[model samples]
Target chain A: MHIQVIPVEGLPIIHPGDLLTEMICERVTFEDGDILCLASSVYSKANGYIRKQDEIVASAEAVRIAQKTHEDPRFVQAILDETTDVILEDPFILSETVTGHVGVRAGVDHSNIEDGMIILLPPDPMGAAAGLQNEIARITGKEVRVIITDTCGRSFRRGQTGVAIGWSGMTAIRDFRGDHDLFGHVLEITEEAVVDEVAGFANFIMGESNNGVPAVVFRNCTRWTGHDNLHFNREEDIIRKALCKK
Target chain B: MHIQVIPVEGLPIIHPGDLLTEMICERVTFEDGDILCLASSVYSKANGYIRKQDEIVASAEAVRIAQKTHEDPRFVQAILDETTDVILEDPFILSETVTGHVGVRAGVDHSNIEDGMIILLPPDPMGAAAGLQNEIARITGKEVRVIITDTCGRSFRRGQTGVAIGWSGMTAIRDFRGDHDLFGHVLEITEEAVVDEVAGFANFIMGESNNGVPAVVFRNCTRWTGHDNLHFNREEDIIRKALCKK
Candidate 1:
């Protein structure tokens, strides 16, 4: 079966108080078991998750980091305000959010929005995903899965790829703990991050520039059962430990 | 346009001399400009990139690292042989291959093939992708893009997602440097690793276990132009520097 990846087009620029779910439902017909991926920036904007840059007072810590990053102190303050743990301050502000998703600037954005304003990642991404799923089901009467996506930089790779910050109606992972390979050998690489996989493709459809696509719908996806432990705790992540040591 | 993701299913277990391009062509009708993602393990298996475990002579360094990682010394030796530089050796042998792709265990596989043997990543992945693209075009008379994929783990995120090790007929990145967002501001997140994004969704369709799927065809994918510098250099990567310091 061929899965269809449909971009939700023709929507106006998202802003505060916009009815994002209704607008998406107007664009494409949703199907049961369909997976919908939304850019976190759009979702945040629609939900009034933006801050006026002038209102944010920079702390001494933020000012220090801003000197190293060469970013505005207020912009650095916005990142520090969203960050739970500051992992790396220089080069870029690599930090963890409240939801345990580690990203540059804690997933804060200074692009795509009005001037003098900044966009934030959905403060409660999992809750945002669940709320959207329920809202879509209520409006369309079709069960649909949702994933909130954020573009992130990888460790060894140079460029950024989309990652799932929050997901609903599916597990974050497709665990293959007892699964075997073609030769009947136990699979060494279990626990596929399927949500992130789907989100990466969704981000491809929703280009970073001014294409105006912020949401995508995927049809005919096969379902799998797994747990939702997508983020590694401080004790488990060896790379995080290494960075902390430095 | 909706992108169609088709999985190449139902082929016999690959032997050393199997004609992989022919097998895929038999299953999938050729279309112009379709992006084909092939798992690196399947490509390696068909091209005889396997080593006999018993024949491998473990170096003293391999033996010492084996005790730390709790793996057979031969497997450690296999990883070391393929590694250009060892990034980490204790938790697992995270190393960079000759093609500049850094991966855990240097992309060696001990599953799906015959017991007592291991599969190696295609020595020249860029060449492998180009050869496959050329072969497919010759046999089917239809132009197609190719990407060699490998499942890899991330630093902050748990579990593995597919990454593009090598690609043909498209840029490794979709450079949006000069593109403007909705607000007409200079784009900060410009370079999108599009090949990796496409490869990631392909991995979702190709499960890790005994589903027997190793290839995926992506139709209607929009192309972009960018440079092919996917992997980061030693001094450029802050994470690598931190790990080396440790």
Candidate 2:
């Protein structure tokens, strides 16, 4: 099926207690069954989750946590700027308020933003997926799926590929073990990452340079559902994740 | 640069002492600097690199090597079928005579061939590169670089991307660290694999489903030369060679 990605822009700077769903839905076009994938850093930026350079005075509690990894104060501050909520302190994964993307540190984007401002990944990406799905359903009277994607490093290849950190309405893993190869061997070691593959394909359309298309409509994907959260799996859980850890 | 890839087909099965460079040059058009990437297995098949399945004598040395890796007898036979010369048995890299490609097990392919046939990787990829480069240069009177490419499993990713196992007249690595980024941070970590990137792009055109395109011509990449193997810094070397163990 031909998929079209549209990047929605022009949202006002968001503040605490803002109606985020309403604000985003107003700007974005919605159709029932459409899957909207948003970048987490953009969400963080609109929400004014900015931390000034001076506000980063590390307290005793912060110092105690940083000591476990032997990290410096600035490193701790960098993490703080990109994080809305700390999930597991040991592994140091964080949640962002903007894009509903969850991972190890929000995509705090030091590349494109001002020195004082850092972007965080979305907080509770799974929750964000559910909310987007529901909001689209309520507004358009058709069920839709939402996937919050973040560009992250892979252990093996040189560049980053898009991953579905938060997903609704899709089975992430496509098992093909019993399938036959062209040589008639029962195919093993070939579970296709359905969500990540689609995300990567969409990422190509969502050009790295100001294409402004943030969301793509994946139509005719009959194997997915919008109400399920059980299918989104972490890359680390798979054997292939070992390649990018370098 | 505009690149064209075409597969070689319809030639009679090759045998030992067959003259490939001249024979192939006669069948196809060559411009100065056109790179020919052939799968070693196809070359081996044409060159009579095969052993009958009924030839059931297993050597003790073969069994010993197979036992060390916990591999089956059939796999061991497959490995033996394509190997023509043993280069440095301690490191375990082999060289095949059929296609002039060298690597582990000599690119003996079982993927797209009939039973009772084994295809070896090209015999001497680097030598093949130089020979083909010279042939193309002689015929077209234009300097050409040749690259002998093969599909090798990457350490991290699930599928294979073509790598330049051998090349002539090309800068394999291009470092752009001193350049400015969009945000003007000293651009580091952009030393691209020019060979691998070109190979990957070639693969998109030379698909597995009988496209009949094996070699591609890349023009306007004059920065690449037929001389000088890429000199790797310690950090880049660590990443490049880390994927394939000795």
Candidate 3:
């Protein structure tokens, strides 16, 4: 399969109330069967999910954690407001958002936007992706898949790679449970996280820091059948169980 | 930036003593700056890294762990032979290799090959990548970067994505430590795992189970400056620490 990955460029600095779908459509001509990946920070900025640092009043919990993290209490409060579960606190706050996605500081960002304003991950990233997909189709009369991406760190690896926080028009996983290999043996590797794989490549193209690239267009990608169970169940996640033990 | 991702197809089932560099060169015309990603299993297979299952005698520790994992003791012994440290023995075997890569079963694969044989990850993946790069350049008279990829599962996220087991001609990470974002604020996200990002996308294209495509060529990818410090130290990894505590 041959695919063309195009970064959507020439976008203005996003501000509150900006129409992101319209802006992206202006930059990219959507085609049927194209996959579009947008950074979650850009989506949050356009949707006014950013918080002003001076406006937040830190609670006692935020204040206590700030002392440990060496972060501003107001910034910590913003993270606390968005978090559903706190996994780590001292070195850096690792928390789970309401959407079943766990990330550092709940995928909060203080960079790439106006100073004094911090961007929070889309409160409803799945809905955000769906809405954006529908809006693009409405504007361009084309079917395009969407994925909202966040850069995240993983266990064992020192550097972070892009991950899909939410996706639309495709399942998060491509299940190969009954599939057989070349030798006709049942495949041992069952599920593949196809969305994260696509999102990671987009992030590689959309380098962080002044690249002006927040979205990417992947054309001619082959579609597959799968289910959308992206996040692990709390009871079944051994890593989460181990961390909570600490 | 616009990049073309092309999957090289039509290669025969690889075997021991096959010169993979020559095989891949036959299928793809190399460009000076193209990035090629090949599955490590394919590399290991061509380099005769497979082991005959019946030739192994299970050790006592392998037999003990096999009972919990419900696998052949000989298979367990093979995984143990490649593992430098056994991280988990229960539900599945999680271990670290001598190269400092943490993976499930030390990346031993029993699928896609002939029965009674198992495929192990390349013993010296970094050297394998470097040698492959040098061989390709010598054969084609074109400069090409190489990444050896392995499909592996990560913590918190369900399913698996491709990761860079070893890479050449580019740093594993793209560091943006002092780089400023759009608003001139120093970037908070410092390191990006670029090799893994490229590898993950290649794996997405190289679907498992009956898909003949294994290698992908990425053209027109922008370059970045960084270091090759991809693995975390044993003491600094909190998830490893937490797992050890359990």
Candidate 1: CAPRI quality band: high
TM-score of chain A for the candidates in order shown = 0.99, 0.65, 0.98
Candidate 1: pairs in clash? none
Candidate 2 residue spans exceeding 4 A from truth: A1-33, A46-53, A58-72, A80-108, A182-184, A208-211, A221-246, B1-70, B73-246
List the candidate numbers ranked by DockQ, top first: 1, 3, 2
lDDT of 2 at A11: 46
Model 3 clash count equals 0
CA lDDT, candidate 3, residue A35 = 96
Candidate 2 per-residue C-alpha lDDT over A4-31 given as tens digits, one digit per residue, 9 for 90 to 100: 3344555443444566556667776666
Estimated TM-score for each candidate: 0.99, 0.51, 0.99
Of the two candidates 2 and 3, the one with more favorable DockQ, higher being better, is 3
What share of the reference contacts is kept in model 3?
0.88
Global lDDT of each candidate: 0.94, 0.50, 0.93
**Candidate 3 residue-wise lDDT, B94-188, digit = tens:** 99998999999999989878999999999999999999999998999999999999999998889999999999999999999999999899888
List the lowest-lDDT window of 10 residues for candidate 2 chain A: A224-233
